[model samples]
Structure formats: structure tokens, C-alpha cells
Target: MPATPASDDLREGSGARALLRLATPVVASRLGIMAMGLVDTVVVGRYSSAELGYHALAWAVTGVVLTTGLGLLSGVQVMTSQAIGEGREADTGAILRRGLVYAGWIALAAALFLAVTGGPMLHAFGLSAGLADGATPVLQVQAVSLIPIIVADAGLFWLEAHGRAVPGMLAMWAANVVNLIVNLWLVPGGNFLGVDGAVASGWATFASRLFLLVLLAWIILSWRRARELGVLTPAPRAPHAAQAMRRVGYGAAASYFIESLAFSAMAIFAGWISITAVAVWAVVINVAAVVFMVPLGLSVATSVLVGRAYGARDQVGMLQSAGQGFAFTTAVLLAVSVGVWLFPEGIAAAYSRDAVVIAGIASAMILSSLFFVADGLQVVAAQSLRARSDIVAPTATHLFSYVVVMMPLAWWLGVRQGGGVDGLIWAIVIASTLSAVLLWGRFAWLARRPLVPLAQPRAA
Candidate 1:
């Protein structure tokens, strides 16, 4: 049958419908990733609250490194999407090849840094001896998982850029299933290894990460068109390829560090207040992170669409993608805001059974919902800007918002003014709002002008 124009628009698949198609499984993939932490928190929180605190602190440290490393490889997705738009699809294989090498180095360096410094870094934060003692082993075990996880991310990003998000989604959930099984077996204190509950959870995470890496790599290698996609051969030198990837990576990495480090510092500050404060803080942040997966998925999908448009110099398409991303993010956050505000207790209870922790988490979550909305906006805006090759402004905004604004406010409001966890959440709300406004404004201005490609052809 001949297709009508309306049917063609729907079937051709570009715009919000297309964006949603891409976002659904990507959101699932993001949620699957978040579920690992959620599972760990639930399992360990039930096993022992004290162990939960240790798990939280260890994760706080690890989260900074994990996010920053992911940021360092952000170029793989951006570049691959752009390559497709530019009719340079074959270059994507080289992008993947280079990205893998970069991922390996990043993973190795991160693992080594964490292994050597994680224990002392906890001590340096002036944590209670008990907290530090409990968290160090967990931290060390988590350090080992970084290698597998980061390398796996390189594959995930590569496949996702080619619009193959379902495979990554499946791999992520499969890893989560493995994570849950291992946590059940190991965190109950009856294991042959005799590991503590917190450390046992860490081992589960390490094993799952290893599984994820293997599964993703196998999927990439076994892809039916692997050679046609350039994965099976050496790439001809494109003078700008390596340089462009590194440039994008550095800016993104710095932006990631600014935000993650600021939050990690807040966790450390929570430690200074009381063991209970950090514990409650952990529960609050974990729940917020679970909700955040939706926007994170949107941001990734939006960036790909925008990058494709930018590569093809389709200004209209770029704006449409960005606008749609912001609209969807705002709508989702509004709904999430209502849920968090009305049922903070229910949300907090899912993580911890203790009355005091639940009360603290609920109170903090009420304030944190505002932060979540602003954070959702800012991340989507930042990714959209990066897709247009406007990277530095987002980095600068992150520095100002997270480092200059958030850090000081967190210290003063949270500690000196005695607002505790609630104060820290408020600080995040302010910083995220500032970042969102600034980044969106920048994207608006940049979109009005032309966007240059990340790489240009060398002299003929």
C-alpha cells in the first residue's frame, strides 16, 4: 500500500516521536544502572543501618570518579552521532576503536588512583574512625569495578550512537539481575568468604560490572555488520579525530568533576555533622538519583538528535530537538516534584527502615525535589549545548554554579548555620537552578548563530 504524507511523517521518525522512541529504552538503561545502587542501598540498609552508612560513604567517593570518567568519554557519543549526520558513518568504527583505548586508560588510571588513595582519602575527610574503617574495604572493592564499568560504557555509548540502545538496555538489566543475585547470596553474612555486608555488596557490584563489560563487548563484536561499520579494520588517519575527541572530553570531564566533586564534598560535610546525617543524606541522594535517570536518558537522546542536526547544518532540526528535550524534561520533573513532595516518607521508607533516618530523608527529600527539577533542566541543557559544539560555556557555568556557588553555600548553610542535610539539599537546589538558567540562555544564544563542526577537513 502507498503511504500517505501523515503516515510517512510518523513512520519516517524524527522529532518528539523519534526522541521518545530513543528515550524509552535509554531511560530503561539509565534506570537499570541506577537500580544497581538502589538495590545495594536496599539490601545493605536492611542488613544493617551502620553498614548502609559505610556503603553510602564509599559510594559518595566512588561516584565522583565514576561520573568524571564517564564524562571524559562523552565525545564518543557526540562524535558518533555527528559522524552519522555528516555521512561519515564508517568513521564511527574508528571512533569506537579509539574510544576503547581511551576507556582502558581512563579505567586503569581511575582504578589505580582509587586503590591507592581511597582509604586515606576517607581518613583525610575526618570521618569517625568507625565509619572510615567500615567504608575502606568497600571503597577498595568498588575501585576494582571501575575498570570493567568504564570500558563497558565505551561500548554502550558507541552502540547507542548508532541507535542500538535496546542491546545496551538489555545488558544493563542483565547486569542488575546478576548484581541482585550476588547481593542476596553475599550480603547475608553466611558466605564462605566471611565478608562484611558492605564489602559483600561491593563484591557483587564488581562481579556485575565485569559481566556488563563482557556482554557489551560481545554484542559489539558480534554485530552482523561489524566490518562494514569499521570495527574490524584499522582507521585511516583523520588528523582531527583524536584531537577533537580529547578536546570535547576535557571540557566535559571538568564539568562533571565540578558537579560530582561538589556533591561528594557535601557527603563529606554530612559526615562532619554526625554519622546519621550522612546516612540520611545517602538515602536522600539515592532516591533523587533514581528519579534522575529519566532526565539523564532524555539528555543523552536529545544530544544525539541535536548532534545529528548540527552535523548536517540543519538549524531547524537542532532547535526542535533541544526544545523538545527541554519540554519533556520539564513535564517529567513537574510530575516527579508532586510525587516527591506529597510522599517523601513513602519514598524514604523504601530505602531505610529506621524512623529517624526516614524522617531525615523525608525532610531532605522535600527540599531536594526542587534540586532535582533544576538538575534535570541543567543536564539536558548542557548536553544540548555540547551537541552544538558549545562546550566551554557549560563547563564555566558548572564551575560557577557548583564550585563557586554551591560549595560555599553548602558549608555555611549545612554546617555553620545548623541546617544539616536539609541545608545541603537547598544549596544544591540553588546551584542547579543557576546552572540551568545560564546554560539554557547560552544554548539559546548559540542556536541563533551557526554551529561549527567539531572537526574540519585538513588542507586538500
Candidate 2:
């Protein structure tokens, strides 16, 4: 079937219902992404707190690269959605092909960069020799997995853009099963492979990512509309289309890189405090990340709606989509914050039995809750802005809120003031609030201006 135009129902004040419908599976899929990491952190933590520290630090480094790569490929979703909204469904296959090629090069460069420089970079962080050495191997193993995950994300994003989120969600959960089984078999000492600790968990991540890539590839290839959508044929040359996709990705990549780098710096600060502090910081951040996926998913859904509306030249539809998205994000995050605040200890205990780590995590987790709503809202606002092609504003907002504001504050409060993990959480809370305010304001300002469809690349 050809792409349908944005329906009147969406413009008739049913946007909230539409947003929820699209967001549910997307949220579950996003949770699946975080669930894999949650399992890793829990398994590694249970195996040994010291090993958990290694795993945390390694992941902190890897996470920055992985998320940035994902951001670069975000155009796969945006372009695909815009094509559909413009009733150029066949053009989406070209978008996917370009995204896949982009994913491949990005994966290779990232993997090589990490393999070559990850270890020395760890050493330069002033971590103890033992900590740096212990994390090096794990980081290298994770580097290998980046290839599969990054490529898989491109396929996943394309499918999600086409409103086929369930397949990706199922594929991700299946991979999680693979990850869990391998982690259980290898993370404990005396395993058949003789591998344990963070290294073993790293292998599990690699296996799961490989599985995820293969599964998603199969799904895309076997999609019922593959031929009709031009997936089976070569995409014709279209420089403008490719350029448009990359242009959007450039801003998103910058935003994602800056934000992730700032957050990763918090882990470095935690390491400076104590090795145990790394474990505590990991647990707190992991929980916060899991919560973050909900908003991230909602953001994707919101962006899709906004992109579609922008394509159809429906300004009212765009505003309604964003309004519904913001309301839903706030409500969901508030509920989550309450749960985290009320039972921080119970949540912390799930990760590790280390008494000191648990205490530290519990306190920091409570403070972390304060930022959940703001953090969630900021991402939603940023994505919505991108969907409307107001990309630079979000990038600039994040640069200021996260890098310029949050990073130095984290260093001072968490390090100089000796507030440790809690201090870092405080910095995040302030930065997220500032980011949300700025992005929301940008969107509102743009809403007041004349509405124009983002220029559609001409077919050659």
C-alpha cells in the first residue's frame, strides 16, 4: 500500500490517542534496548563488585560512541517518516539503503577507534593502573560489538519509521534472551570458557548484538512490502536526498555526542572519588537510563507525528502532536520518579549486595529521580524540534545545558565539594531542567512563525 496522508483524526484533537498508540510499542522497544544493559549490570554486579566497576567504566566509554553513532543514523527515521508523509513511500527504501551504508562506515570507524585508543584513553583518566587494565579488555570486547549494534540500529530505525515497531521490539527481546543466557554461563568464574567478570559479560553483549543484527536483517528482507517499497532493487542516485539525511544527522550527532560525553564525565568523576563510587554511579545511572528509554521512545513517536505533519504541511497537527507528547512525557516521568523516590533501597539492592555500594546507590537514585521529568521532557522537546527541521536549536541548547553547564558543575560538586555520586546527580538535575526549558521555548518560538514544509529532495 502507498503511504497514507496524515489523517483528519490527528488534527481533530485525537493526537493524544494517536501518540499513545504509536508510543506503546516504541516504548517497549526502547525498554528492550535498556533491558540488555540492565541485565549486564545486574549480572556483572552480582558476580563481583570489583568486576562491576570495570564493566561500568568500560560501558561509560562505549556508551558515548554507541549513542553518537545512533544519533548520526537518526536521519533514517526522520527521512523515512517524511517520505511517507509526502506520499513518496518508495523513496523510503533509498533512505534505508543510505542509512545502512552510513551505519557500516560508522561502525567500522568506531570499532577501530575504540580498539586503538580506548585503552590509552582509560589510562589517561588517572584511574589506578589495575582499574584501567581491568577495563581495557572489556572495552575492547565491547568495541567489537559496536559494529553489529550500530548496523542493527539502522534497520530498527527504518522499521520504526514505517510504523512497524513490533518486529524490532521482538527482535531486541530475543537478543536479550541470548544476552542473558550467555551472561549467566560466562560471567561466573569456573565457566567452561574460563572467562568471567566484565570480560565474560562483554562477550555476551557481542553475541547478542550479532544475533540482533542478523534477526533485523532477516525481518527487513522478508518484509511483505519489500519489493513494492523498492527494498529489493537498487536505489537510484539522489544526492539531494542523501545530503538532506546527513544534514539532519549532523545536528543530531553533535547533540547526542555532547550530552553523552558530559554524562560519561560523571563516571570519570566517580572513579576519582573511589572504585566503589564507580559501582555506585553505575547502578544509579543504569536505573536512570532504563527510565530514560520511556521518554526516548515517546520522543520517537512524537517526532514521527511531527515529521509527518510537517511533510503534509499540517501546522495544527504538528502542534497537537508535540503538545500531547509533552503532556504524556511529564505524566509518565512523574509516576516513575515517585516509584524511584519511595523505594530507592529496594531498587539498589537488585543490582548488588555490596552494602556500601547499595547505600550510595540508594541515596543517589533518590536524587536522580528529581531529574527524571526534566530529562524526559528535554529529549522529547529536542526530538520534536528535529522532526520539524529546527535541528540546530536543539543542538545548541544541549551544548549549553550539558557541556557548558553540567560538566563543570559535576566536577565541582561531585569532586571538589566531595559530594560524590549525589553531587553528580544534582548537576544532571539542574542541566536537564535547563535543557527542557530551552528546547521547549525554541519549539514554542518556532510554532509562532510561518509554517513551511522542510524542502523535499527532488528525485533525479
Candidate 3:
């Protein structure tokens, strides 16, 4: 039998501790993800900055394809979590079935896009024909494995729906270890092959993800008792669940798309300053992303919990989860911000040696640390709001914050005022703060007068 929290545990008073307990897995998962990114950049940086740039850009492009489909993972998580929260075993099964179907389609699309259309597109971006050519085979081979990665995403979401996040966390962390080992063993100096080493890294990602998928499958079989719980059926239909998922998926994707575009454009902004500026900007963004892993995980936990409450139509639970989650995210980021602000230079130096690069990155990191806190809060609040099925707010917020607010503000401050890169960094801070304030306000309003998604699958 699946373990359930004590009766009193679900009450509003216990929400914070319960949310924290829920958040632990997410924190570990996010850290695992950060470690993987850090290691990838560090190991590749050992080869050359040029190689780092090439690899980063390549990975980014590949991500654009796979990451979008992984969008369904959140959709499944939100909907399935809601199902679990409502105590509808049949609905959970139905939601999982739909999620698996969507995952499969996303995997196929990733495979084809990377194999066929991906390379020439990169070449068009001014990559040396040779470097682009060299990366193609790697991308294609890696694309074949991208499907498995999304499968892992689906598995993790399934686990999250059941409030069993540790297995998912372990699966991803294990993937990180496998990646590190493979990179050490196969990459250029380690494997004695230059371009071939990078290729090996992609294959390693594939191998690790596939392994995790199997382990996750095992967990589902054993712990879930999915069959006995009545959450597994021969066939399930959940278009309503799918629709609810897509509602958030589309919103989150919009937010993701705009944020990614803004940062990607920062590279262009750096190019205006100098080549070294690009390198510096790269380091700052990378480190920032790693730092973000902390709040990102927290935000996701909030979403799952809030999404569950939203599903249950439990207004008090929704408000408590949202409040405690936001408070937790803010507290965590405040600590992080203080540390980064105090020693931006120290942090940058740890990543790179060039004095100019270090100075720029430190300046950027210091200026941007608080910005991340705001961004973190906004992301969680916005996601929870979406889980409540108030999708228009997050959409408007993304458009208003990034496209309307940040992009224009960045140009004025960064370019018009000639604040240059630091000016651009300040723009991010401005947008993030607004996003947090606005999202929190909106969340407060929604929690007061909640909007629920589709009715709980009609009680079996």
C-alpha cells in the first residue's frame, strides 16, 4: 500500500513543514542538474573557450527541441498531482497514460529534428562549416537518446504525482554521476580523441538517461502498487487532463521562450562589447542558472502542492501552500543573494582565470543575484497560479515582464544609456522584481477567489 501523510498533516497549519518535506527531493534534483551543467562547462572549458562556445550553443539548440516536449512533464505533474490530491486513483492512471503518450510523441519529434533539420540550421548561424559539420553527427546520435531523456522526465513527474520525489531525485543524480564518469573517460584528453570526446558526452547522456528510465520503471512497478491502487488500467482516456496540462505547458513555455530569448540576445549584447565579453557573459549566465537551481526546485514543489490543492478545490490548503512556498523561496534566495553580492569577484575567479572576464562576470553576478531571487519567486508564483487554471495571468505577466518590460528596458539602459553589459544585467533585475511583485499580487487574488481546472475526473 502507498503511504499517506497523517490526517492532521494536510491541515493549513502544517503546510510549511509538509511543503518543505516535499521540496527536499526537488532541491536535490535541481542540485543534481546544476552539477551536471557545471561539470559539462568545466570539462569542456578545459578543452578551449571556443569549444565551450560551440558546445554551449549546440546544447542550447538541441534543448530548444527536447525541452519544449518536456513541457508535457509539468503538465502531467500538475494534472496528475491534482489527481492524487483528489484521491482519484483511476484519474491518476488515466493522466499517466496520457502523459506517456505525449512523452513518446515528443521523443520522436526530438529524434527527427536533430537528425535532419538541426545541423544546417546551426551552420546558418555563422558556425564554421567544419565545426557545424563536426557537431552534426554528435547531435544526431544524441537526438536518438533525447527521447529517453524525456522518458526520464515523464517518470520523474509520475513519481512527483505520488509525492515520491526521492526516487526521481536519485534517478537524475545518478544520471549526473554517469555523465561525469563518461566525460572523464571519453572526452578528448581523457579518451585521447578531440571532437570524438564531445560526441562521447552526448552518448553518455543518452546512456545515463536510459538507465534511469529503467530504474524509474522498476520503482513504479514496486512502490506504486499502481495496479492495486486502481491507478493502472488496460486503457485510459484523459483528454481533459491533457487539456489542463497544456494550459500550463503553453504558459510556462511562453515564459521560458521569452526568458531564453532575452538571455540569448545578451550574447549579442556582449558581442557589441567584445569577444571576451561574450566569454564573461557566458560564465555569469551559467553560474546564475546553477544558482537558480535552488529556487527552481522550490518553485516546482510549490506548483505540485498548489496544483494538488487546486485539484482538490481546497482553498485553505491552496493558500497555505502558496504562502509558505513563496516565503521559503524568498528566504532561500535572500541567503544566496547575500553571499553572491559579497563575493562576486571570488565566485567569478573560481570559474575562469582571465582578469577582465572575471571582473565582468563578478560585476554581472553581483548585480544579478537579487534579480534571480525575484525571478525565482515570480516563476513559482506564476506556475502555481497557472496550476489554479488562471493561465491568462502568467501569459500576460510573461509578455508584460519580459517582452514589454525587460526587453525594452534592457535596450534603453544597456544600449541607449550605454550601461553596456551591466546595464543589461540591471534590466533583468528590474524585470524580475516586477515579476515577483506582480505574480505575488496575482497569486493572492487568485487564492482568495480560486479558479479550479477541470472537475476531478467525475469521481471515477
Span of 10 residues, lowest total lDDT, candidate 1: 2-11
- TM-score to true structure, per model: 0.95, 0.97, 0.88
Show pairs that collide, candidate 3.
Answer: none
Model 3 RMSD vs true structure: 3.3
lDDT order, best first, reads 2, 1, 3
Q: Compared with the true structure, what per-residue lDDT tens digits does model 2 show for residues 1-460?
A: 3323323323344778778767888999999999999999999999899999999999999999999999999988998877777777777887898889999999999999999999999999999999999999999999999999999999999888887887999999999999999999889878876889999998899999999999999999998787777788788888888888988998999999999999999999999999888999999889989999999999999999999888778899899999999999999999999999999999989999989888988888888999999999999999999998888999999999999999999999999999888889999999999999999999998999878545754451
**Whole-structure CA lDDT of model 2:** 0.90
Per-residue lDDT of candidate 3, residues 275-376 (tens digit): 566567667777788888888788778887787787777888888888888889889889988998998888777766667767887888878876878888
Clash totals in order: 0, 0, 0
Predicted structure with the largest TM-score when compared to the true one = 2
After TM-score superposition, the amount by which residue 27's alpha carbon in candidate 3 deviates from its true location, in angstroms, is 1.3
